[model samples]
Target: MDAMMMDAMSKDMMSMPGMESMDMDAMQACMDACSACEQACTVCSTQMMDCAPACMNCADMCNTMMRSMMRMQGMTPAAMMAMLDACIAMCQVCMDMCMAHADESPVCKMCAQACQACMDACMAMKATMATA
Candidate 1:
Protein backbone atom coordinates (compact mmCIF):
# COMPACT_ATOMS: atom_id res chain seq x y z
CA MET A 1 0.00 0.00 0.00
CA ASP A 2 0.99 3.63 -0.53
CA ALA A 3 2.16 5.94 2.24
CA MET A 4 -1.03 8.01 2.05
CA MET A 5 -3.21 4.94 2.42
CA MET A 6 -1.10 3.80 5.35
CA ASP A 7 -1.46 7.20 6.94
CA ALA A 8 -5.23 7.09 6.54
CA MET A 9 -5.37 3.56 7.94
CA SER A 10 -3.20 4.60 10.87
CA LYS A 11 -5.51 7.51 11.59
CA ASP A 12 -8.42 5.12 11.65
CA MET A 13 -6.70 2.26 13.51
CA MET A 14 -5.22 4.46 16.22
CA SER A 15 -8.52 4.73 18.06
CA MET A 16 -8.63 0.99 18.70
CA PRO A 17 -6.55 -0.02 21.71
CA GLY A 18 -4.68 -3.12 20.56
CA MET A 19 -4.80 -2.22 16.90
CA GLU A 20 -2.95 1.00 17.63
CA SER A 21 0.25 -0.99 18.13
CA MET A 22 -0.03 -2.87 14.82
CA ASP A 23 2.65 -1.92 12.32
CA MET A 24 1.36 -0.50 9.05
CA ASP A 25 3.41 -2.90 6.94
CA ALA A 26 2.03 -5.93 8.72
CA MET A 27 -1.55 -4.76 8.35
CA GLN A 28 -1.04 -4.06 4.67
CA ALA A 29 0.44 -7.50 4.10
CA CYS A 30 -2.48 -9.15 5.85
CA MET A 31 -4.99 -7.21 3.77
CA ASP A 32 -3.22 -8.11 0.55
CA ALA A 33 -2.98 -11.74 1.57
CA CYS A 34 -6.70 -11.90 2.30
CA SER A 35 -7.53 -10.33 -1.01
CA ALA A 36 -5.35 -12.73 -2.94
CA CYS A 37 -6.74 -15.72 -1.10
CA GLU A 38 -10.30 -14.61 -1.78
CA GLN A 39 -9.63 -14.31 -5.49
CA ALA A 40 -7.88 -17.68 -5.68
CA CYS A 41 -10.71 -19.40 -3.83
CA THR A 42 -13.34 -17.83 -6.06
CA VAL A 43 -11.61 -18.99 -9.23
CA CYS A 44 -10.94 -22.46 -7.85
CA SER A 45 -14.59 -22.85 -6.85
CA THR A 46 -15.69 -22.80 -10.47
CA GLN A 47 -14.43 -26.38 -10.92
CA MET A 48 -17.73 -27.87 -9.72
CA MET A 49 -16.30 -30.29 -7.19
CA ASP A 50 -17.23 -31.01 -3.57
CA CYS A 51 -14.69 -28.33 -2.67
CA ALA A 52 -16.72 -25.70 -4.50
CA PRO A 53 -19.07 -25.05 -1.56
CA ALA A 54 -16.25 -24.56 0.91
CA CYS A 55 -14.35 -22.33 -1.48
CA MET A 56 -17.44 -20.21 -1.88
CA ASN A 57 -17.77 -19.91 1.88
CA CYS A 58 -14.09 -18.96 2.27
CA ALA A 59 -14.40 -16.32 -0.43
CA ASP A 60 -17.27 -14.67 1.42
CA MET A 61 -15.48 -14.77 4.79
CA CYS A 62 -12.26 -13.29 3.40
CA ASN A 63 -14.17 -10.45 1.76
CA THR A 64 -15.97 -9.76 4.99
CA MET A 65 -12.67 -9.68 6.88
CA MET A 66 -11.11 -7.20 4.47
CA ARG A 67 -14.16 -4.93 4.56
CA SER A 68 -14.39 -5.12 8.38
CA MET A 69 -10.78 -4.00 8.70
CA MET A 70 -11.43 -1.21 6.24
CA ARG A 71 -14.38 0.03 8.30
CA MET A 72 -13.08 -0.57 11.81
CA GLN A 73 -15.35 2.08 13.30
CA GLY A 74 -18.35 -0.22 13.03
CA MET A 75 -16.66 -3.08 14.89
CA THR A 76 -16.87 -3.68 18.63
CA PRO A 77 -14.78 -6.21 20.53
CA ALA A 78 -17.74 -8.59 20.72
CA ALA A 79 -18.44 -8.24 17.03
CA MET A 80 -14.80 -8.73 16.14
CA MET A 81 -14.68 -11.91 18.17
CA ALA A 82 -17.76 -13.24 16.45
CA MET A 83 -16.39 -12.41 13.03
CA LEU A 84 -13.09 -14.07 13.83
CA ASP A 85 -14.88 -17.24 14.88
CA ALA A 86 -16.87 -17.25 11.69
CA CYS A 87 -13.77 -16.74 9.57
CA ILE A 88 -11.96 -19.55 11.35
CA ALA A 89 -14.90 -21.89 10.89
CA MET A 90 -15.14 -21.10 7.22
CA CYS A 91 -11.41 -21.57 6.71
CA GLN A 92 -11.51 -24.93 8.41
CA VAL A 93 -14.28 -26.05 6.10
CA CYS A 94 -12.41 -24.86 3.05
CA MET A 95 -9.22 -26.52 4.12
CA ASP A 96 -10.98 -29.82 4.62
CA MET A 97 -12.63 -29.67 1.25
CA CYS A 98 -9.51 -28.68 -0.64
CA MET A 99 -7.41 -31.33 1.03
CA ALA A 100 -9.67 -33.99 -0.41
CA HIS A 101 -8.49 -33.14 -3.89
CA ALA A 102 -5.06 -31.72 -3.14
CA ASP A 103 -3.21 -34.70 -4.59
CA GLU A 104 -4.92 -34.39 -7.98
CA SER A 105 -5.36 -30.66 -8.40
CA PRO A 106 -2.74 -27.96 -8.01
CA VAL A 107 -5.45 -25.33 -7.64
CA CYS A 108 -7.01 -27.16 -4.70
CA LYS A 109 -3.66 -27.32 -2.96
CA MET A 110 -3.07 -23.63 -3.50
CA CYS A 111 -6.56 -22.80 -2.28
CA ALA A 112 -6.00 -24.84 0.86
CA GLN A 113 -2.74 -23.04 1.57
CA ALA A 114 -4.42 -19.68 1.08
CA CYS A 115 -7.21 -20.66 3.43
CA GLN A 116 -4.66 -21.63 6.05
CA ALA A 117 -2.82 -18.34 5.67
CA CYS A 118 -6.00 -16.31 5.98
CA MET A 119 -6.93 -18.27 9.07
CA ASP A 120 -3.53 -17.55 10.58
CA ALA A 121 -3.85 -13.83 9.88
CA CYS A 122 -7.31 -13.69 11.39
CA MET A 123 -6.06 -15.54 14.46
CA ALA A 124 -3.23 -13.06 14.83
CA MET A 125 -5.71 -10.18 14.67
CA LYS A 126 -7.95 -11.88 17.20
CA ALA A 127 -5.02 -12.39 19.53
CA THR A 128 -4.21 -8.71 19.37
CA MET A 129 -7.81 -7.86 20.17
CA ALA A 130 -7.82 -10.19 23.17
CA THR A 131 -4.71 -8.55 24.55
CA ALA A 132 -6.35 -5.16 24.21
Candidate 2:
Protein backbone atom coordinates (compact mmCIF):
# COMPACT_ATOMS: atom_id res chain seq x y z
CA MET A 1 0.00 0.00 0.00
CA ASP A 2 2.71 2.44 1.01
CA ALA A 3 4.83 1.47 -2.00
CA MET A 4 2.04 2.47 -4.39
CA MET A 5 1.49 5.66 -2.44
CA MET A 6 5.20 6.46 -2.55
CA ASP A 7 5.33 5.80 -6.28
CA ALA A 8 2.54 8.30 -6.85
CA MET A 9 4.16 10.78 -4.47
CA SER A 10 7.46 10.43 -6.32
CA LYS A 11 5.97 12.22 -9.30
CA ASP A 12 4.73 15.07 -7.14
CA MET A 13 8.03 15.18 -5.33
CA MET A 14 9.92 15.68 -8.59
CA SER A 15 7.89 18.81 -9.31
CA MET A 16 8.28 20.25 -5.84
CA PRO A 17 11.07 22.77 -5.43
CA GLY A 18 13.97 21.41 -3.30
CA MET A 19 12.43 17.92 -3.33
CA GLU A 20 13.23 16.84 -6.86
CA SER A 21 16.10 14.68 -5.64
CA MET A 22 14.41 13.30 -2.57
CA ASP A 23 15.13 9.65 -1.77
CA MET A 24 11.96 7.69 -2.27
CA ASP A 25 13.51 4.52 -0.81
CA ALA A 26 14.29 6.24 2.45
CA MET A 27 10.81 7.73 2.56
CA GLN A 28 9.24 4.35 1.96
CA ALA A 29 11.38 2.73 4.65
CA CYS A 30 10.44 5.43 7.12
CA MET A 31 6.76 5.06 6.35
CA ASP A 32 6.94 1.29 6.65
CA ALA A 33 8.76 1.57 9.95
CA CYS A 34 6.19 4.00 11.26
CA SER A 35 3.38 1.69 10.29
CA ALA A 36 5.05 -1.26 11.98
CA CYS A 37 5.82 0.75 15.08
CA GLU A 38 2.25 1.95 15.29
CA GLN A 39 0.95 -1.61 15.16
CA ALA A 40 3.40 -2.85 17.73
CA CYS A 41 2.69 0.01 20.07
CA THR A 42 -1.04 -0.48 19.71
CA VAL A 43 -0.71 -4.10 20.79
CA CYS A 44 1.68 -3.25 23.57
CA SER A 45 -0.61 -0.56 24.83
CA THR A 46 -3.18 -3.21 25.57
CA GLN A 47 -0.85 -5.05 27.89
CA MET A 48 -1.77 -2.81 30.83
CA MET A 49 1.86 -2.41 31.77
CA ASP A 50 3.83 0.60 32.97
CA CYS A 51 4.68 1.51 29.38
CA ALA A 52 1.09 1.46 28.15
CA PRO A 53 0.70 5.21 28.09
CA ALA A 54 3.98 5.75 26.31
CA CYS A 55 3.13 3.02 23.84
CA MET A 56 -0.21 4.64 23.09
CA ASN A 57 1.38 8.04 22.60
CA CYS A 58 4.07 6.60 20.37
CA ALA A 59 1.47 4.88 18.26
CA ASP A 60 -0.36 8.14 17.73
CA MET A 61 2.83 9.96 16.79
CA CYS A 62 3.85 7.21 14.38
CA ASN A 63 0.49 7.33 12.66
CA THR A 64 0.77 11.11 12.32
CA MET A 65 4.29 10.83 10.96
CA MET A 66 3.22 8.24 8.39
CA ARG A 67 0.27 10.32 7.31
CA SER A 68 2.41 13.42 6.94
CA MET A 69 4.85 11.52 4.74
CA MET A 70 2.01 10.30 2.59
CA ARG A 71 0.82 13.85 1.99
CA MET A 72 4.06 15.13 0.53
CA GLN A 73 2.34 18.09 -1.12
CA GLY A 74 1.75 19.57 2.33
CA MET A 75 5.31 19.09 3.51
CA THR A 76 8.43 21.23 3.24
CA PRO A 77 11.85 19.73 3.87
CA ALA A 78 12.13 21.64 7.12
CA ALA A 79 8.71 20.47 8.24
CA MET A 80 9.44 16.90 7.29
CA MET A 81 12.74 17.04 9.17
CA ALA A 82 10.94 18.36 12.22
CA MET A 83 8.35 15.59 12.02
CA LEU A 84 11.08 12.98 11.75
CA ASP A 85 12.81 14.42 14.80
CA ALA A 86 9.58 14.29 16.74
CA CYS A 87 8.90 10.72 15.66
CA ILE A 88 12.41 9.69 16.60
CA ALA A 89 12.10 11.28 20.02
CA MET A 90 8.73 9.66 20.65
CA CYS A 91 10.03 6.28 19.58
CA GLN A 92 13.05 6.66 21.84
CA VAL A 93 10.91 7.37 24.87
CA CYS A 94 8.56 4.51 24.05
CA MET A 95 11.45 2.15 23.46
CA ASP A 96 13.06 3.06 26.77
CA MET A 97 9.80 2.58 28.62
CA CYS A 98 9.03 -0.72 26.94
CA MET A 99 12.52 -2.05 27.45
CA ALA A 100 12.10 -1.70 31.18
CA HIS A 101 9.54 -4.52 31.17
CA ALA A 102 10.76 -6.40 28.12
CA ASP A 103 12.11 -9.24 30.17
CA GLU A 104 8.70 -9.93 31.67
CA SER A 105 6.43 -9.01 28.81
CA PRO A 106 6.77 -10.35 25.30
CA VAL A 107 4.62 -7.55 23.95
CA CYS A 108 6.93 -4.99 25.47
CA LYS A 109 9.94 -6.69 23.94
CA MET A 110 8.34 -6.58 20.53
CA CYS A 111 7.28 -3.00 21.01
CA ALA A 112 10.77 -1.94 22.01
CA GLN A 113 12.23 -3.59 18.93
CA ALA A 114 9.71 -1.88 16.71
CA CYS A 115 10.47 1.48 18.32
CA GLN A 116 14.19 0.99 17.72
CA ALA A 117 13.55 0.17 14.08
CA CYS A 118 11.32 3.22 13.67
CA MET A 119 13.96 5.47 15.19
CA ASP A 120 16.60 4.09 12.82
CA ALA A 121 14.34 4.56 9.81
CA CYS A 122 13.51 8.15 10.84
CA MET A 123 17.21 8.92 11.25
CA ALA A 124 17.91 7.49 7.80
CA MET A 125 15.16 9.66 6.33
CA LYS A 126 16.75 12.68 7.99
CA ALA A 127 20.13 11.81 6.49
CA THR A 128 18.57 11.40 3.07
CA MET A 129 16.94 14.79 3.37
CA ALA A 130 20.22 16.32 4.45
CA THR A 131 21.98 15.00 1.35
CA ALA A 132 19.14 15.95 -0.93
Candidate 3:
Protein backbone atom coordinates (compact mmCIF):
# COMPACT_ATOMS: atom_id res chain seq x y z
CA MET A 1 0.00 0.00 0.00
CA ASP A 2 2.81 2.38 0.90
CA ALA A 3 4.60 1.38 -2.30
CA MET A 4 1.54 2.29 -4.29
CA MET A 5 1.34 5.63 -2.53
CA MET A 6 4.96 6.27 -3.28
CA ASP A 7 4.44 5.41 -6.92
CA ALA A 8 1.61 7.88 -7.10
CA MET A 9 3.75 10.51 -5.40
CA SER A 10 6.64 9.85 -7.77
CA LYS A 11 4.34 10.31 -10.71
CA ASP A 12 3.00 13.56 -9.29
CA MET A 13 6.55 14.84 -8.91
CA MET A 14 7.62 13.86 -12.42
CA SER A 15 6.86 17.33 -13.71
CA MET A 16 9.13 19.06 -11.21
CA PRO A 17 12.67 19.95 -12.21
CA GLY A 18 15.32 17.66 -10.74
CA MET A 19 12.63 15.38 -9.33
CA GLU A 20 12.32 13.01 -12.29
CA SER A 21 15.19 10.89 -10.99
CA MET A 22 14.41 11.30 -7.32
CA ASP A 23 14.17 7.98 -5.52
CA MET A 24 10.83 7.53 -3.82
CA ASP A 25 12.27 4.87 -1.55
CA ALA A 26 14.77 7.31 -0.16
CA MET A 27 12.07 9.93 0.27
CA GLN A 28 9.86 7.51 2.17
CA ALA A 29 12.70 6.35 4.39
CA CYS A 30 13.68 9.91 5.17
CA MET A 31 10.11 10.90 6.01
CA ASP A 32 9.68 7.87 8.24
CA ALA A 33 12.94 8.54 10.02
CA CYS A 34 12.05 12.20 10.54
CA SER A 35 8.69 11.28 12.08
CA ALA A 36 10.28 8.71 14.35
CA CYS A 37 12.95 11.14 15.42
CA GLU A 38 10.34 13.78 16.15
CA GLN A 39 8.36 11.42 18.35
CA ALA A 40 11.43 10.16 20.14
CA CYS A 41 12.69 13.64 20.76
CA THR A 42 9.35 14.79 22.10
CA VAL A 43 9.28 11.87 24.52
CA CYS A 44 12.86 12.43 25.61
CA SER A 45 12.15 16.10 26.18
CA THR A 46 9.61 15.24 28.84
CA GLN A 47 12.28 13.54 30.91
CA MET A 48 13.47 16.98 32.11
CA MET A 49 17.03 16.26 31.11
CA ASP A 50 19.69 18.74 29.96
CA CYS A 51 18.98 17.67 26.40
CA ALA A 52 15.40 18.86 26.58
CA PRO A 53 16.01 22.03 24.61
CA ALA A 54 17.89 20.21 21.93
CA CYS A 55 15.24 17.55 21.82
CA MET A 56 12.50 20.12 21.35
CA ASN A 57 14.41 21.87 18.62
CA CYS A 58 15.16 18.62 16.86
CA ALA A 59 11.56 17.57 16.98
CA ASP A 60 10.47 20.80 15.35
CA MET A 61 13.12 20.50 12.68
CA CYS A 62 12.19 16.90 11.95
CA ASN A 63 8.55 17.87 11.61
CA THR A 64 9.43 20.63 9.18
CA MET A 65 11.65 18.32 7.16
CA MET A 66 9.01 15.62 6.94
CA ARG A 67 6.31 18.11 5.99
CA SER A 68 8.50 19.65 3.32
CA MET A 69 9.12 16.24 1.80
CA MET A 70 5.43 15.48 1.77
CA ARG A 71 4.57 18.82 0.13
CA MET A 72 7.20 19.15 -2.53
CA GLN A 73 4.99 20.66 -5.18
CA GLY A 74 6.83 23.98 -5.04
CA MET A 75 10.04 22.74 -3.52
CA THR A 76 13.22 22.96 -5.53
CA PRO A 77 16.04 20.46 -5.32
CA ALA A 78 18.30 23.14 -3.87
CA ALA A 79 15.75 24.08 -1.21
CA MET A 80 15.16 20.47 -0.30
CA MET A 81 18.88 19.90 -0.09
CA ALA A 82 19.21 22.87 2.25
CA MET A 83 16.43 21.55 4.46
CA LEU A 84 18.12 18.13 4.57
CA ASP A 85 21.35 19.76 5.64
CA ALA A 86 19.58 21.64 8.40
CA CYS A 87 17.80 18.49 9.56
CA ILE A 88 21.08 16.55 9.58
CA ALA A 89 22.78 19.24 11.63
CA MET A 90 19.92 19.46 14.12
CA CYS A 91 19.85 15.67 14.48
CA GLN A 92 23.58 15.64 15.10
CA VAL A 93 23.30 18.20 17.86
CA CYS A 94 20.36 16.45 19.47
CA MET A 95 22.07 13.09 19.20
CA ASP A 96 25.18 14.39 20.87
CA MET A 97 23.14 15.94 23.65
CA CYS A 98 21.15 12.74 24.16
CA MET A 99 24.18 10.49 24.02
CA ALA A 100 25.74 12.36 26.90
CA HIS A 101 23.22 10.80 29.31
CA ALA A 102 22.19 7.73 27.35
CA ASP A 103 23.81 5.52 29.95
CA GLU A 104 21.42 6.82 32.57
CA SER A 105 18.30 7.58 30.54
CA PRO A 106 16.54 5.06 28.36
CA VAL A 107 14.56 7.81 26.64
CA CYS A 108 17.74 9.61 25.76
CA LYS A 109 19.17 6.46 24.27
CA MET A 110 16.05 5.97 22.20
CA CYS A 111 16.10 9.59 21.03
CA ALA A 112 19.76 9.37 20.11
CA GLN A 113 19.15 6.26 18.08
CA ALA A 114 16.25 7.92 16.28
CA CYS A 115 18.34 10.98 15.59
CA GLN A 116 21.07 8.87 14.05
CA ALA A 117 18.57 7.09 11.83
CA CYS A 118 17.09 10.41 10.72
CA MET A 119 20.54 11.75 9.92
CA ASP A 120 21.39 8.70 7.88
CA ALA A 121 18.10 8.85 6.00
CA CYS A 122 18.47 12.55 5.26
CA MET A 123 21.99 12.00 4.01
CA ALA A 124 20.79 9.23 1.76
CA MET A 125 18.10 11.50 0.37
CA LYS A 126 20.65 14.22 -0.19
CA ALA A 127 22.88 11.83 -2.08
CA THR A 128 20.00 10.71 -4.26
CA MET A 129 19.16 14.30 -5.11
CA ALA A 130 22.78 15.21 -5.78
CA THR A 131 22.99 12.61 -8.47
CA ALA A 132 19.68 13.59 -9.99
lDDT of each: 0.77, 0.88, 0.90
> What tens digits encode model 3's per-residue C-alpha lDDT throughout 102-122?
999989999999999999999
Q: What are the models' TM-scores?
A: 0.85, 0.92, 0.92
Question: Candidate 2, 112: how far from true, in Å?
Answer: 0.2
Q: What range of 10 consecutive residues in model 2 has the weakest lDDT sum?
A: 9-18
Off by over 4 Å in 3: 7-10
Provide the lowest-lDDT 10-residue window in model 3. 9-18
Ranked by lDDT, the better of candidates 1 and 3 is 3
Candidate number that wins on TM-score, 1 or 2: 2
Predict model 2's lDDT versus the native.
0.88
TM-score, candidate 1, is 0.85
* Candidate 1 lDDT by residue in tens digits, 1-132: 456776765476644433454434545666666787799799889998889988998898888877776666667667767987898789889988998889999999999999888888878877766665
